[model samples]
Target: MPVPSISTKKLIPSIAGKLALAGGSLVFGSWVLSDIVHLPGGGAGLLALGAGVWWVTRPSKPASFSEPSSLPGWIRRCEAVLAQFSELELSLGLDGLRSSREQELDRLKALHEPLSVGVVVSEGGTHPTTSELQIALEGVHSLELCIAKPLPVVADAWSWPQELEELDVILYGLPMPLRAADLLRLEQLPTDRPAWLLIRDSVHQSREARQEALSCQLPKQWCDRLLFWSGESADLRQGLLPVRSHFVQPSRSREITKQRLLTSLHRRWQAELEQLRRERFRSLLQRSQWIVAGVVIASPVPSVDLLAVAVVNGLMVKDMAQIWGCSWSSEVLQVVARQLGTAALGQGVVEWSGQALLGMAKLDGGTWLAAGLIQGLSAAYLTRVVGASMADWMALNAGVAEPDLEDLKRQAPLLVAKAAERERLDLPGFADQAKEWLKSQRYAGA
Candidate 1:
């Protein structure tokens, strides 16, 4: 007779089936050993051996082909037990996540509105020529504009229309450079709304003449918003119309002028948005520096202080990266930490801080408390320097540059010095502000 061959596919399951039968037999044997066996120890030993064999040969379930109704009750029970551990009940699906993100984006978009613009023309001065006025009006489709003359009120007292007060931007239309008196009158108006000085004739003037006109015609404070608006090309227009009454059906030239103006205004608005973002980032950096300084002061060990500084600076860089729309990761943090560390070492900031603390100790009766305060101030100043340097680096790269140690090292000292000077001037106010901020944070946490 030929030897029978076992199929490999069926062999394991056959063995497993035998093992399961043996396990049941062992369980029954255990009962028999206790209840009936005359030689109990021998029966118990056999039971244990059977159990071991069953454990070693235990089988996995085969792929299910039966209908749900045919599934074993025990197998269904096992599935129920596994389902309890699954995250399907707790977590959202991909569609849910995408919807949440879109809602957040819509909320942010709702915070923005069209820029409000007001056009100011002095009563005594010449009005903007028809061409100049047209150019100024074309691109301002998004702004709400109103023509206002200097209110004939008391010197240093001018009332803006309620509408103008609500406006976000102002365009001052000047026929010629203002007299000194008019400049002073301009200064008395609210500084809250940003104003632009649109000089009608200065576009064709020499650079020196324009500067002289700005100096003589505008207040020193308003020089920042001054611009030459010679209506030579139809390209230089700004602000929005106050009423639809000012609107007219456009000729081809007028339409072209409107297009150019709109383009220019859009570019300006984008630039303003970028500037506002930078300012907000800088403010956050300043606050972070102050908080880190507080942490350093509270830390007992100098090494811990250093570590905190590095960590905080790294976080600040990460925030700046986000503001600039750059990806932040561990590698970015490491780059920032390395750059800050190198700058600190190169500038002898640590030694300077130590010396400064010692000096402050002498002045403040040499107490530990005084020393801690001084050290904190020093740390705060150094953090500001690091933040300022990082800000400059980000600005230079426009937030897209690869991490470079050499660039950071080179830029740090100059920014550090500037930051130090700023800190010196603003220390008292900053300290007060920081204290208030800390108290608010503590309250919030509580």
Candidate 2:
């Protein structure tokens, strides 16, 4: 089971912080207005507070996913993802995959050849060694055994080759008293195939010691499939069952391996596609935030500012949905965006941004220009938070036919917090960008 990107324990605190910020912003902004513009403090405060509530809770019209321009880089990347999926399905024996050009297809067909197993030996000691395992498997037919050591580590991680097309099931050996380095290495191995960790124990080792060794931390996936082995021929033979099962019925075994491979391939490819989409989204997010900032600066009315930001964020959500291959209608995407956006507002993303802007005012000196900049940056940061949370939600639910908007509403605050935490790590970068944007605006005015 996949763990959610954001945890529930932190969700409450995050939402509370946002609400506090929102309330604080309303009170403070209204006070500042009353003091500076000479209006009755209470009336200004109440008006601002009311306006804030109305804008945030107001229902809006649905927006659609925008069509891509002529082969934009993102479109090309999306096409690449589709192509990878098509090839994977074709390799898994799916029919009706029409290629545009009448090119050759032998390479794709060759991927379905007879099953091959690889025995990966750890560097150190092991009972019923590779030679012994080979002797135990003397009579097994139709299985090509490839013997190899774990790939050498480069820069503290396993350096995998471009393709592992030849091997299907990898029987990885692990000596007793599993080292952290070995576990780290295991983590880097390709998950797109059946991998079994063979824990080797000495025949002379005590049962207590063996139990202690077995108690070592292992991931849940590896824990169930763990094979305990000693030097005895019976132990080795029994331990080999999982690996041998792959070759039991050569044809049936082939299909099973292909199916397993396909499932893992889908997961790996989804991650790859998401990573690519994330890179593209950075630009989209930056652009949306700047636009939101500009609008907020031009017209600082709370409702109008939020509405403009919402429109920009709606378009962003549609593009993200399309990027993640979501088939949901624009209405569905907008519901998701609204859910996350509301959470962002409730959690005080805008308030936090306003506070940070005010903090900068200590050095920059107080002015209405600074106030506009503050609101603009707040809206921009709110967009960033909402966009990030939406991206997280869509990525987790990418392949699901129907995503539950209620579940998103429940998870929205935690997701926003998690995204905010990550985005804040790049605060200096954002600050620098804001500076450059401000400078550019000044130059444009001149």
Candidate 3:
């Protein structure tokens, strides 16, 4: 199975092309067509001029990759891995920042919309990540960002002021060993609204924060609703405890390995899908295309039990009928196709199918049931007749498992008679061929 790599390469140059074509056409036409068309060389020259003009007038390609930005080697590696896996960035250091510290702040600025910001900064321990904090606080619906910035690092945690002001949201990014004193200070703070507290460390640290709150004399809202988040550097398993979690590509080898494993699994999925297509669902694809192309054959020998579903998206079904082989009947086919997920199909099926089909060819599947039916019906005509290997692979591969022959028998009761007739006549491929011919030929006097 081919794993579809994230594409960083741009396919086309946008504009500046139209202008070139327009100019080329005028130049070629006037230069070659000087002589009258009534003469021989005149006509030839006219056509030649027109050709030259069009060629020269054609648009010139545009430049790519805008400019060269010096990115750190580690940063480049991070970008590559993040592109493979959806990554979230944390932003820290707001006092040093002039405006919203987003990567694309300028792009957002052009909208000229009033920004909604949530700032929670304190002078304390472990500083927040600049990228991660900014990204987490960004809310598209409210067009606001709720950031937490602590004050200068100080040994005395309780030295901070009692009631702060202008805080849309409160975020705490202190160290792992949280003390009971931290909760007392938080309670003293002015805001009764929601407060986002950072709780890094492992399982032990999370338990400490919950314990600290429980021991305090704070109100029910403060004790019960206080949000505890594992700090940015904490492990993922540790971080999942918080009600809301943000994921960023870790700048480490272990995280990169995890991303690659995910990619491999994705590829294996595609390989299985493709194997099913070649083995049993190819006919369904061809038939679906015929329907879309609106062509009907001379006779309807086998019924196409297709079920059409209207989804929010239409691009999901490009040669998707292969899914029907998962279970026979157009109805089953359509359902599975829709279930494949629109997110997966955005990158094109053939490429993904090859990736998924690579290893799946080795796996045992019910898809052969459909192909077996096809072969069984085709056997009626021999001597330059159709053939199918429904049960032949396990015959040679030795390692292949025989499906419950009883279950295969139970799948399609009516098709059994058609298959037996073809098998007795020694032309097992007839069923598929007959269907194909039926779809391809047009009825003359319908």
Instruction: Give the C-alpha miss distance for residue 75 in model 2, angstroms.
Output: 23
Spell out the clash pairs found in candidate 2: 18-347, 18-348
Tell me the tens digit of each residue's lDDT in model 2 across 1-446: 23235456744467778789878977777777777777676656667677889899754422222333322333343445567556534433544433521121223223566567777655663435657777666556756667774554334555444445447677777765676666776777755457788776666877566655565677656755677777677778887887787576776666555444444433454565566667667888899888888878887775533564476556587777766667888778877887877777787777876776566543233332566777777788788878878888877776566787756776787888888887778766777777777777777878
* Cα-based TM-score, every candidate: 0.40, 0.65, 0.22
How well does candidate 2 match the true structure in TM-score terms?
0.65
Name model 3 segments beyond 4 Å from true.
Answer: 1-124, 137-139, 142-149, 152-164, 174-176, 179-184, 203-220, 230-446
lDDT of 3 by residue, 191-227 (tens): 4333445544446545665647554645455554444
Highest-scoring model, lDDT: 2
Model 1 Cα lDDT, one tens digit per residue, 1-446: 11111123421357778779877877787777767775567566986776788688655332222223221332343233223213222321212423343343333223334444556665665445555565556554454445565544345545455546444556666555346545655766755345666665645557566766567655567766656545554435432233222333323223333333333333343354346445656677777766775677677455534654575555677777655545556576567656665565566665665564454433334233555555665666667656655655554444343554444544455655554555557655655555555455446658
Candidate 3 TM-score versus the reference: 0.22
Better of 1 and 2 by TM-score: 2
Give per-residue lDDT, candidate 1, residue 150. Answer: 57
Best-to-worst order by lDDT is: 2, 1, 3
- Higher-ranked by lDDT: 1 or 2: 2
lDDT of each: 0.52, 0.65, 0.34
lDDT of 1: 0.52
